[model samples]
Target: MSGTLALASAIAEMDRDALESLVRRRRPQAPAGVLDPIGLAAELLRPDSILRALSPLDRDALAVLLGLAEEPRAGLARDTDTRTAERVSALLALGLLGVEDARPVALPEVTNALRHALMTAGHRPDDLSTPPPSRSGDNASAPPAAPPSADSWVTAALTAVGQTAECLRVLRDRPARLNRSGSVAVASVRGMAESIGIEADHAAQALAAADRAGLVASGGSSLVVSERAEEWTESDHIARWLDLAATTLATIPAPLRAGLVREEPLAAIAAGLPERFPLLSEAESTAARRFVVAAEYLGLSSHGRLSSVAELLHSGERAAAERLVRDLLPPAAPGVYVQPDLSVIVPGPLAPADEIDLAALTVPEHIGVASTRRVTEASIAEAFSRGITPHQARAAFARVSLTGIPQPLDYLIGSLAERVGNIQVSEHHGDDGRTRIVVGSSELADTLTVDRALQHLQLHRVDPTTLCSRLRADHVLAALADARYHASSPRARASAKAATESTAPPRAQDAHDDLPEALSDLVERVFLAARSEPGTSNFTRRLELAIRDRVPVRVTAEARGQQHTFLLLPVSLSGGRLRATDQAAGVERTLPVNLITAVESA
Candidate 1:
């Protein structure tokens, strides 16, 4: 057998990922059907096998080559233009074109791909009178561009990042841990969103971005903040926003992203959308808008839409993000506003340290454009408890307040600090003669009755403020302080290693891996979820077929509390419980058979 025939045989046996990878390589190789041009050409005329590798321009070039298939030249420039010439040369290099009668001719592979594409779109042999499906290019979104004069978008994205991270913390750090899955219970998502005071849809996007960014990841039983979370929290707000935005843009359809990075506008790109994607025109338009949302928030597009800078980020131009921020957020002299209502306002984004310091001493009322903080004596004392001295805390407020710290705030800070540590906890012997927890307050114990922890012990009256729990004096004091009794514990024991042992902090990751792999996994996941007509009779038969064949199927089931569009390959359907493998998570899940409301093709 000819070597070309052997190579073609090997190519035909490869899996989808392997085959696509090989074809996608920048080094275009001789296609499989080189030896028997007639046979190979016939196969190429079939659609799915090769058109997946061709862009619209490549397809158009292939169509031109087809029109001249009967001509005999080694190669054809088509036109003198560089792009046209390059396209023709690419066809030759990819083995899509070969010499026939000494004229450049379409290989069987190209013809087959074109035919397959046409027939897949319902074309008929007798209907060559109309346009071929391969030549129809109305579906793609146009190349995207940003409008001018828009507000900075990075700021909005940063706000989203903050909100997302905090929401993840609420979910993962809760006493009752939430379940973690590729398709987590939407009810849980809604509950967490409610806890964080955001819409479920918004929270879902944030969670997706956070998961993609590697700050939060599945930990088998529950979602947990990964080690990356530490570095994420430490990174500058702008850096965090850029990271999330990169992950978001990475999710755009690859062809669209490719075109954008190559400097195509959305209108131009839009022309190729309808024919390529399953999405409708509105969805295509929304996707184009999606690419611009994060960009506009980053102030990369002052004009209000996607800009060249955003395309740069999508293309892995890391340095472009910094440049965009620097060019857009020019440094301005800091300014402050102090109001009669005892609030401090920063006219713009705060210096990093000042933002943290302010949070420790004030409650934010507003965030964008101008930041407003309402100050109270309790907040001032809270900062002091964190080792910020009264003088230092007052100075921080003064530095950020135009009036140099309001007189009422200053006096309140002093008064609170003076008696802050008065209520104390100590280890003492009760009448029973065992070491127990007791509050040592110079003030009357009647004020301690309001402590929630004390209420848990049913201690309405505080005679020596003793609690019945087995907790340490230090723990008791901290809990009381948290409840605003301002407790301290002088007699609490210290750890033996407290003086000698110094702990190390988390090391930062230089860069994260698994991004491309994870992105691919996500694509496969979406591909596996099927939309179905709601019901059980037909769904049961489909479920059985999938189970018997070991193929993945999506089950849209509504259980008592476990409602979801589930993607799973059934492992068993016994005991009125459907046991299946969740491909996205690579985990086993069991659902009550009765919950299998709908099953659909995947």
Candidate 2:
């Protein structure tokens, strides 16, 4: 019978919670042999350990030990069977169990040894137990009687710090002391383990051993270095880590080094090297220069005109590189310079001398310009109130020489033009030949669309025109119109129409009459109000509301040379149809009013 088997049997007889509680209650304040069974097991199994001196026990002996250990009343009764007694006695002989004043108690040394063996075997310890540092030494410099291997001290240092300096720091700053007398806390250990690439259970076991060594103390809520163990933490862990980092940097390929070092300071760069690097002795200036060079290579710093320099280096154009160096010298602000290989120079204060060959510098493919233009949208209702006609608005737009179309401005202008029959798009080409498009409409819609588009593109670092080129203008116009129409009320639309008509030329009335009922219905639903009064007004409102609720209407067919489209059903109608002969198209295809699914007043 062996003590471990005896303990296992004892534990098996109790419910899980009871067993756990019992272990917890019996845990010692300091690392003790009994505090870590798994760790003990590992130590016992080591090649030359004391545990190797004992012969292996049978299962019956283990079961007997477990039964004795778990029982509240420890001793086997006098009447107990001979078989159980024999097993119990073997466990006692093995030092796994002790009879204290005739009561059975687990020997602390035995438990510790068990824990060590279990850990070595990859079995989870019932408790967290940091293994002692693989090696230890006194501050004394006298050589060992048996000289140590060159790598021994280094290995010892690494083990003392754990797998990585990062891990060491985490262990050093643990918030709660782990109770290693029971199963490891996977969550608590995992939180720190993942940062250093070790498995959670392995880390927990290691941490448990550290705890036993007094390097870490359990402060109920967190782990901290014990006052007594503070001296053990004096080693230059950070310096060692820095050395490791530098080595890692040196091994990176030159081309990739720039990106790797960029944005990191010299000290930061030195913190990621492997353990063997010589960090403590490196010169600060040298480190800084190396860091700076790496950063410049990585595009982390502005080392002259970055693109130009990169290009010169990649192209292997030495003459051009020299010329760029003279042109971009000093690499300071408020200087017109060029990037060339290893050097950056500025020729003079403002302009380079004739000797400085500008021709050697390569021009980047794309350039960006920032510009803005004004647009206006006056509500038809307001214009009518002011006795202003659509024609007058058009004339006003033309007088301003804002009639030419700008590519990016098309969507904005087209959207406004769709609402009022008389809107205009004007582009004025400046002396620089850059065109500006101005749209005339009710000020509100124009402002909103422009503001929204500009804001959206701000994050993309592109101009409105560039952004628009990537999008389908017709789609944008449709979306804008739908939004505008849906937002306006029936009363608002009616008011706008009345105002526009008041100042509109007589011909404008005929134009209104010519509009397709479906289009008109959309306008009314979007901008006009349904009169509470009966008859014509009520019928029109009802029809508009019904259409708005049913059909998924959208601006489908756009005007020639325009980005904006007119309102139409998303899908063509199939069965029943209504026709409007008086409209501009002279034919309005009616859809089943009931089949209409969605309507957008906008």
The C-alpha TM-scores of every prediction are 0.52, 0.17
Tally clashes: model 2.
90
Report the Cα lDDT for candidate 2: 0.34
Lowest-sum lDDT 10-residue window in model 1: 496-505
User: 1-602, model 1: which lDDT tens digit per residue?
Assistant: 11122223333333445433434432222343222222332343344445544433323454555544534342364546676567665565444555432344555555555565556655432343234354344344754343533234545654575565555455433411345434556776787777555677766666666766766654444455566665765665666667777766666654455445334434445454544432223454566555454444433443444555565685678797667755664343264766667787767655555555666677555544445667776666555544467777877877766667667777777677555534545665554322244433324355455555566433333355544434545555666666665644444213212211222322223233222443344323322221112222345545654665578888888856766887899987656678899998889998877777777767
- The TM-score of predicted model 2 comes to 0.17
lDDT score of residue 71 within candidate 1 = 44
Q: Model 2, 1-602: lDDT tens per residue?
A: 23332232333233433333333323222223322222222233233443442213322343343345445354366217787666565454333564433445554455555445545644444222222222233223654233222222232223323333234345443443345653335676788766445566446544543443344444444454445333433433322222332222333332223223323333333343211111112343245345444323232223311234323433446466445434433221233222222122322221121111111111111111111112324333223223344455344323322223333233433453444333221222433222222233435334444555433322121233222222333333344354343122233345433432232111112211344443333323312121122212211222332233343233322234434323443333113332212133544544443333333333
Report the C-alpha displacement of residue 19, candidate 2, in angstroms. 33
Worst 10 residues of 2 by lDDT: 362-371
Candidate 1 Cα misplacement greater than 4 A, ranges: 1-118, 121-213, 219-226, 229-252, 261-272, 276-289, 296-304, 311-324, 332-344, 361-364, 373-399, 407-602
Q: How far in Å is the alpha carbon of 369 misplaced in model 1?
A: 3.5
